[model samples]
Target: MLRIKLKWFHSLRLQLFVLFFLVSAIPFMFFASLTTGRIEAYFLEDSKAEWMRQANLVVSQIIQTNNYLKEGTNYTIFTNKIRELSQSEEVNARIIVVDPLGYVVADSSRIDLNTTLLNTQIFNALNKKNSSERYEKAGNFIMSTAVSIIDKEDNDKVLGAVLLSASINDIYKLLEDMESQIYFLSLIASLVIGLLSFFSSSIITRPIKTLMKVVQRVTNGQLDQKVKLNGKGEMAELANAFNHMTEQLQLVDQSRQEFVSDVSHELKTPLSSIKVLTESLMCEEDVPVEMYKEFFYDINSEVDRLNVIITDLLLLVKLDRTEIMLNINETNIKHLIANILKRLSPLARKKDIEMIYEANKEIYAEVDEVKLTLAISNIIENGIKYTPEGGQVKVKLQSDMQDVFIEVEDTGIGIAKEEQGRIFERFYRTDKTRSRDTGGTGLGLSITYRTIIMHTGSIQVESEEGIGSTFVIQIPIKHV
Candidate 1:
């Protein structure tokens, strides 16, 4: 039982319920005390008033024969009348006639009838005839009195007191009994409320638990794992979000696995060819001397393609881990773009594509010279690769107070809308056929995106199929 209780307290939902029960029960227990007090007060007030009334009846009867209470002549008759009245009911009653000076002339319940009642209580009552109530010193009794006496008129103006006492053993006993009953009820009530609260908490937390399980499955490589929480409300919205995330994640994982397999195949194809062709060339008897030159050139080109793929893959790995720190300087943007254009102008000339810079004005910004140049170069290079003869490639630089912008535009075959969103994903190629024939590694845009972002910048692409594409980069003017 103790271990079970400990486990209950350990559960978050049950713990909350137990704490709520304790806090609520405290106030409820105090309220029960007040209720019991009111019950006791009401019982005592009504009971005392009724008992006082019955005791005063005997006093009223003696007042009718009140003359006997004054002198010794009829004292015996008065005592007999009081005794008769006292025995008539079960209420303990005592009649004591004390002189204004504290002499006990008669006491109905006192067997030694003539004993002097010189107690301070009797003197106090005789001195003032109005009634008063008090408890016994022992704390066991409630005592009250109604005092009436003969006025010195000898016609018997009532001058003595009637003393009434009721034992309150039952009042306190009743309060204890009521307390026991209330505690029992509270215990039962707490158990019931705790159970209800536990069930309610479980209901509220169930959807979140399902989400956790789904995320765990996803983490364990089951990227297709999805949760269903169809209850109409915020939980439903969360479930929808989880499903959407799961779908996107599954797509990403499939693409990543395909990318690895593609890399292996791409690397293996060239290496296998080079190895076979080289071995054939080494066998002088199998290969003709005329074919050696072409074979060596083809092997070198394949080696160059392999080297480029490995280099792009290495750059991507470095960017992904953020291990490459930017070595920044305050450099003139005008000089940088001029240098890049100069290097690429011969390629544009060879293809008859127009290479142009929109703005000739000097722009200044704090940036890493190598990374910013690389980002701009990658986009422009991509533009140069895809653009046909007579196509146009343009570079622009501009700035505001908060940011600097670099935009590369090309009148080349633009990407389809469906492919534009994943343009920056690693190993993602825009035109699969063109990418394969041109031997592109597909990490150019991905590396450009990561490098620009590392400088607290954003890169975006605007494109329409068969029209053109513009790649824009916005970098903060100041760096920390």
Candidate 2:
């Protein structure tokens, strides 16, 4: 039972319920107790006043029979009068009359006649010049009152004193009944609040529980799972964020799978060529010298292709890291583009394509020379490769106060509009068959995109399926 209680104590629902109950009920209980005490004091004071009035009437009667009281009368007439007063249903009290000597002359209960009254209040009343009343409390909710009895003709003559002892059990009973009602009402209020708290807690926690379940499914590799929440506060915002995170995770997972497939396919092609070349050489023993040289040259070319693929993969991994560092230098943009075009002009000449360069005399900027060169080279090389014979490959460089713009345009087989957005994605090709025939690894544009982005630059493509493509590259004048 203790263990179960401890377990319940750990629950948020129970804690919330208990907290709400205390917040609501404790003040009510405190006020109820305060009200009860005030009422008890009021009733006690009122009861004392009523008993004092009754004692006054008895004192008046004693004075009416003052001659008998002074002559040592037995108080028979006084006893009869008090007995009638005491028997009334409204008063629950004992009446006592004390003589001048502080001795009990009469008691309404009729059991202590002639007993010496040593009470301090009775002695104090015997000395008072006029009628006086004082009260004290005892066991059984009893109140004792002492009132001085005086002669009506000479109010200064103290003949005797009256003592009224009253039991207030009925008043106490009323207080007890009221306290019980308060306790009962408090119980009902706590129950109602607890019920409301339980439902309110449920409303708050339902979305959290659903999110936990969806997270569990995602942890188990269910990337497609998502949570739907109808709530209209923080919970709804949290659900939207959670769904967005899951969507990004799904995209990352899909991209990873495609990366693995592309990597394997890229590696397999060159490896198969090397294998076939070696197998041919092995089959033909003592082959011709020129045939051997040609086969060895072919094998060496495939190895170089394999090396290029590995080098690009390594460069991409380095670029993906958060700690990538660039060697910044102030280089003339026009000179850089001219150098790239000059290096690639031989490849263009092989296809009978014309290379054209247009730029300002000098446009210097702080940039990573190697990375920017690779990015620009890939675009111009693609332009030269894809353009038909006698086509023009144009390289134009322009600059503003803040940035330098490089444009590479070619009269080549342009890309479709739909494929332009994903052309920068790794291992994506507009025409895979043509790309492969032209020895394009499909990673050049991806590398170009990453390099340009690292320099805080932007690249855009404008193309139609049959028209030529224009590649625009924008580089910042200074690193931010």
Per-candidate TM vs. native?
A: 0.70, 0.63
* lDDT per residue (tens digit) for residues 1-480 in model 2: 111222332376777888888877887788778888998888877877787787787777666654666766655776777776677675557888778888777778978887888667887788772232334355467777788877777877888887887777788899999988987788779777977997699776667777777877787788899899986789899989989999999999999999999999999999999999989989998899999899999999889889988988998999988799999999988889999988998999999999989885699999999999999999999998888888989988898899999999999989988899999888898777887788888899989999999999999999876669999999999987
Alpha carbon lDDT at 201, candidate 1:
80
Best by lDDT: 2
Query: lDDT score of model 2?
Result: 0.83
Q: For candidate 1, what's the RMSD?
A: 6.8
Deviating ranges (above 4 Å) for candidate 2: 1-12, 18-191, 230-237
Model 1, residue 167: C-alpha shift (Å): 4.0
Q: What is the C-alpha lDDT of each candidate?
A: 0.76, 0.83
Please provide, for model 1 over 99-201, each residue's C-alpha lDDT reduced to its tens digit, 9 standing for 90 to 100: 5555666666685366666555566556554454646657675645655454555534446666555566677788779878887787777777777887788
RMSD of each: 6.8, 8.6
